[model samples]
Target: MPSIKRKVLVLIALLVVAFIAGIIFSPFLRETTYQLKNWVGKPSPLPPVSKTVILYFSTPKGELLSPVERKIPVKKEINDEIRMVIGELIKGPKTRSLFPTVPPETKIRAVYTKGDTIYVDFSPSIVKNHPGGTSGELITIYSIVNTLLENFPSYSKVQILVGGETINTLAGHIDIRGPFKKNPEMIEQSKILNR
Candidate 1:
């Protein structure tokens, strides 16, 4: 009985040592674990495919913003898609009749969604390079707010931020201290599609 007990203890100890060594020396096992983790919870590594997205841009007359159909790469993640949408908006409209609302030099630093509110962070150039007028600010703010709400129904509102900090206004006109909802009245009367 004593010999049997000793053999059992040795077997258990050998199993533990082998398990530890496998963890330490086996790269395949370690890589498999990492891949499993990513497969379960992380976004896919495959590049997002391009999709048609309607982006709102200020018209040349500045009377109201107009919708322009644009093809942009959209990711599986909603935040990533929002970032891509904003990046395309900054690139300006291809049509000569429409113009960009955000500054040409502005860069989107980050984009995130919390509950129904989407927060967009832009570089300081959004404010510094802005044309700074009531109409311009309204177009800029509404263009962003409308674009997000129009594209993704999951988001109800949008909050603009500069360098991750919220300001009272984008260009000292419209109050942007809180999230802004879509204003259908600000869109062009003729261009308002059934959404």
Candidate 2:
């Protein structure tokens, strides 16, 4: 039988070897052992390792604009702005005066969103003479539709209403009941890029 002192010496040697082996072969063991030592009983005071992730907003041009990007609330999408841009484009090459002629009384009431369809509401003045003839009206309406549908391709149809009332003709032509599809005529040189 070994003496108690000799047994103590043997146990100490084994513990030292285990400690060294753990340090060299597995760093995880040290962490587990430390945690176990602290959590033997009662509540464990140590905090768990965090694994949360956060995302930052960025433009297509790779410009970072997030917590540090704006003093005022920033819009993540430009669907409305893009649609307006198309409207300005429809007003003609010299579209700088488009806004002033919009008629303050004639304003967009609301835009109803549905699956692949958008219903845009405008004031009564929209039905007024919109400069161009049937072609002008076609160009105007289609410009808005095509631009919107392009900016948001997910949508397949668009409907325009005048002062909460659905008009039969934009300028004595073109049907307005059904949601209108994108107008191919408005698309520039390259209409639909397949690739």
Candidate 3:
């Protein structure tokens, strides 16, 4: 009878230990079990390490803007990312269907952010090399404005600065004296083609 009681007590002690362990490790065990059961399928996809920046380039006719997405290394600073995007714009469109808006010779001088506005300073080549006409100027200005505003929606306005000073117009057409907002109508919504 004493041996029987000892066995019963031992079994109860083991059950108590198992219950405590289950309570302590239920979450971990549940996750491990789930992973094991789902192991037959493909592994979960990894998060994207790079980010896409939408760049606007003029269409062949230079009348409207077309957006092209370019993947770039994510930058810790917002200004650095903005500079990267502008640099891509200067590089021009990868697809032949789109034309460059910013002058190829142009260089980004600096990019600054204040409140909801972004100030982009460019080299004088932007003005000197610009193909100046009302439409040309409009495309150029809106290209910069739309690209910046679209990618970074936090910024509501963009001001273009040439040679480190605020410019009244990109090509003596549109008044660029103040910050410009995104012009959705200027962007071609018919299609989104990326290279």
Candidate 4:
């Protein structure tokens, strides 16, 4: 009986050592163990949670912007979250009735905050690929500004930049040299699409 007890103790020790080694050396095993713990309801660092954000797009019939909801993974930092939001905006609206405001070729270069202002830097395509018009430019600019302001109320304004430098305009229509506040006048307040 004593020998059997010793054998069980040895087996337990071996398992503990193996578990420790797997966690230290094997990424796959570590993920599996984390998942197992989740399944077993054991307390573990929760997976990155997702939050719903409202993205603005141009309404097909008129020049006004419309809001659409999307689910995005929550980021550890606010700046990363801002990037994700803008990335989603570039992807365009999921609803058929709403038109995409940002140029498809546009790429986010950087996003940062200072006091109550957020600066969003984009690639040159935002200017080069823009459709070009007062109405079009208005829609595009407000689409980004409204999306950011709506999602993060803490940031009161957004400054648009291109290729790491501040730009005066997207397509020579609206003045973009200064930071922009949320223009509720440009938004279609009644309609909100979920996707």
Candidate 5:
């Protein structure tokens, strides 16, 4: 027995409620929204530019090596070059370890640069008895890259080798060949580990 105007009002109210529910719970709407956000496009280029990029490979034994190269400064961004990064990075302890399991004889002997490659030679003790894990491996990897990239700021890629040979594996898990871009994600992890 509702009046015509009252029925029309009731119908409008039901439609509005249904629309609100769809907005809150519809899966199709959610998928469309996320897809739009991801369409934002590629990563913007680094402003400061980068000098050398490190390449990481994994061996079943968990050993790491970085064979660096210097560029001719053709289209390079930072002027410091990879040698500066090596000098600075090597000057530090080289190992940002909290466990104290690393051997004392383990040391980085020299950092050499030629053209677009930088070579870092370390004492044999470095790979002597080091244990391996994802955290440890990435920490070591980022330690070198973060230090070098901070100094050179150009190049854009790196190749890592052991005693002058590029190994294919880190702890028999990760592949460390080709070119590896510096990982910004490591910055936060470094801070946490430092503290």
Candidate 6:
């Protein structure tokens, strides 16, 4: 009967040790288990890390603009997303037939949203390096306005600034002192292709 009592005590002690070990190791076990599950092809609950956006770039003819698809990292805020899209636009199009309206060397200084207007500021290169002409200025200005308004419906107008100051015009043609709306007429109807 004493031996039987000792065996029972040993079993209870083993159980108590196991309980304490489980308490100590539970978090580690859970983390490891989750990693293992992910390694085995379990999909994570997080949203997609990137998304596709359409950017408008001028065709080589400079008479009209066309859509160029770009894949960029997803941003939490709309303004940040717009900045990313604009940055991509500044990078120019991958297709040889298309040309960049904004100067290739132009840098995006800032982008912000207020009410229904989105203000985009560019470095002095935008104005200084731009090919000054009526058609050139129209293409550059409309390309930005159309790209922003088409992709982001929430914004109705876009205001352009050069080196943080409001520019009277981009190239002595179009008045850029105020916000501009999307001008679909500037876009080639036949060239509107989506990817």
Task: Arrange candidates, best lDDT first.
Answer: 4, 3, 6, 1, 2, 5
Candidate 3 vs candidate 5: the TM-score winner is 3
Each model's lDDT comes to 0.87, 0.53, 0.91, 0.92, 0.49, 0.89
Which regions in candidate 6 have their CA more than 4 angstroms from the true location?
Answer: 1-44, 191-195
- Count the clashes in each prediction: 0, 0, 0, 0, 27, 0
Q: Is candidate 4 or candidate 5 better by lDDT?
A: 4
Worst 10 residues of 4 by lDDT: 39-48
Q: After superposition, how far is residue 20 of candidate 5 from its true place, in Å?
A: 99
lDDT score, residue 158, model 1?
93
How do the predictions measure up, each by TM-score? Answer: 0.72, 0.48, 0.75, 0.76, 0.43, 0.76
Candidate 6: residue pairs that collide: none
- As for candidate 3, its clashing pairs are none
Runs of candidate 2 with Cα error greater than 4 angstroms are: 1-106, 190-195
Kindly list the per-residue Cα lDDT of model 5 for residues 44-161, writing each as its tens digit: 8865543344322221233333322322232442333444444434333323332232334546555555555445555544455445676555655555555455445544445555
Rank the candidate models, highest TM-score first: 6, 4, 3, 1, 2, 5
Task: Report the alpha-carbon TM-score of model 3 versus the true structure.
Answer: 0.75
Q: Which regions of candidate 5 deviate over 4 angstroms?
A: 1-104, 114-117, 189-195
Better of 2 and 4 by TM-score: 4
Best by lDDT: 4
Lowest lDDT 10-mer window, candidate 5? Answer: 186-195
**Candidate 3, 70-91: lDDT as tens digits:** 8888888999999999999999
lDDT of predicted model 3: 0.91
- lDDT of candidate 2 over 30-105, digit per residue (tens): 7889899888867657653321211111112222111111111222344454335434332332222122223333
